[model samples]
Target: MKTYFPYQLKYVGVLFVFIAIVLSCIGNVDEFMRGLLAGRNDFETSILNEEATKVDQTLAYQPYFSEKEKDNYLKISLILSLSGFILYLFSKEKSEDEFYQQLRAKCLTQALLVTWLFTGLIYWIRPTYQLNGFYILQLHLIFFTIIYVYNKKWKFGTE
Candidate 1:
């Protein structure tokens, strides 16, 4: 079968990574602003009162993103990360042979394994409250790192 991603797709993957990073940074800044603003007594009291009766029953003092803003960033970041992953995964190799195909499969499997294990470890160690906004942010980084390491180790079909 023919490869779906051309050799040029590697560049697209890189571009997606850049976009993800920028969007992630903006999300982080928004989070920081929320936290900073929440420190005010009036905002803190209002938030606590508003959230105390919610079903979550957790801390009522936590910072929250505006729904629209959070959803926009989440959707954009997810799309960018997924696009980057697909491009990186299917991009044509220099020598698209049986060995390269085997290596690609191996790498993909290993990456999934590593990502799942790492996520499990984090979940085991960290509180759910602490994991809120950071989960998606870390997921993209983990995926990129795994793919990058495998590509570097295999020299991306250079063998």
Candidate 2:
């Protein structure tokens, strides 16, 4: 059963989710290995002797996400992608068929701009709490922005 998404935003959403999942898995693995090695032997002791009492603190900042938040992001991403896919299905063809493309491009561009504003505010606030999911959302915003910009300027279509 195919649904409509109003535009082809679903592919973009899916791509974002896929990228986020892969990056998150990689990050988790790296963190687990580092923790494991730290506790496996005298490595931590050696680090302590090196006068680095706060070795872990010096590492790259890892965003923290509550279990509920993680689940929510995943669910939202899936829903958004599905909606986009459905829109694509229900779209009607114009005489030139460029109107729909342009409309979708504009919509995506607006979404990206809005998201960028949010992310910019996040950067300015110097937040005490960080979350990997937030970063993923920001990335998706930029990604969609780029896609819209590219498609909007292409000469292949005329609205």
Candidate 3:
């Protein structure tokens, strides 16, 4: 019988948008990673004078990222996807509690950290096309900061 605050809905809406944006960027990164694998093969085959498979040049390969780096990229993807889903399910007015607040903070922190790592990796790799897209990083930072500030006075502060 408890009614939820209107601001609660807004908070949920903002979180959902943040989650959606992060998810979309992660999906694009995954596609790019696949292209990188294909491009590496193509580069090797071309060097050997073998036929190279058609590679989408638009999908560029990140130079200097070894297998470990590639696996790290995938790890973030899985973490973000799973955490985002869990947050969405628990982000409700009636369900709002310390648990939910802590969950949101944790999810945002993970997303921001992953964003920073990914951007740093791309910068370190120095791709051929100078793929310096930091939009996703900025978005995550803004969202994380906003949410952290909002939850600071709440029971779950940076949990």
Q: How many clashing residue pairs appear in each of the predictions shown?
A: 0, 7, 0
Residue-level lDDT of model 1, residues 33-112, one tens digit each, is: 64655465445467677654452333234535566887788779767977776676678877677765676666656666
- In model 3, where is the ten-residue run with the lowest total lDDT? 1-10
Relative to the true structure, candidate 1 reaches a TM of 0.63
- In lDDT terms, how accurate is model 3? 0.54
Top candidate on TM-score is 1
Model 1 per-residue lDDT at 105: 68
The Cα local distance difference test for each model comes to 0.66, 0.53, 0.54
How well is each residue in 20-136 modelled by candidate 3, as lDDT tens digits?
A: 556556546756777767777667667754334433344356554555665565556545544443343333545456665665657577667866777668778875545324445
Better of 1 and 2 by lDDT: 1
lDDT of 1 at 159: 40
Clashes of 3: 0
Off by over 4 Å in 2: 1-53, 60-63, 96-159
Give the lDDT of residue 23 in candidate 2. Answer: 49
* Model 2, position 156: C-alpha lDDT score: 38
* Model 2, span 44-124: residue lDDT tens: 556576645466555434545555665665566545544443343234433325565565566566667767776678867
Q: Quick one: RMSD of model 2? A: 13.7
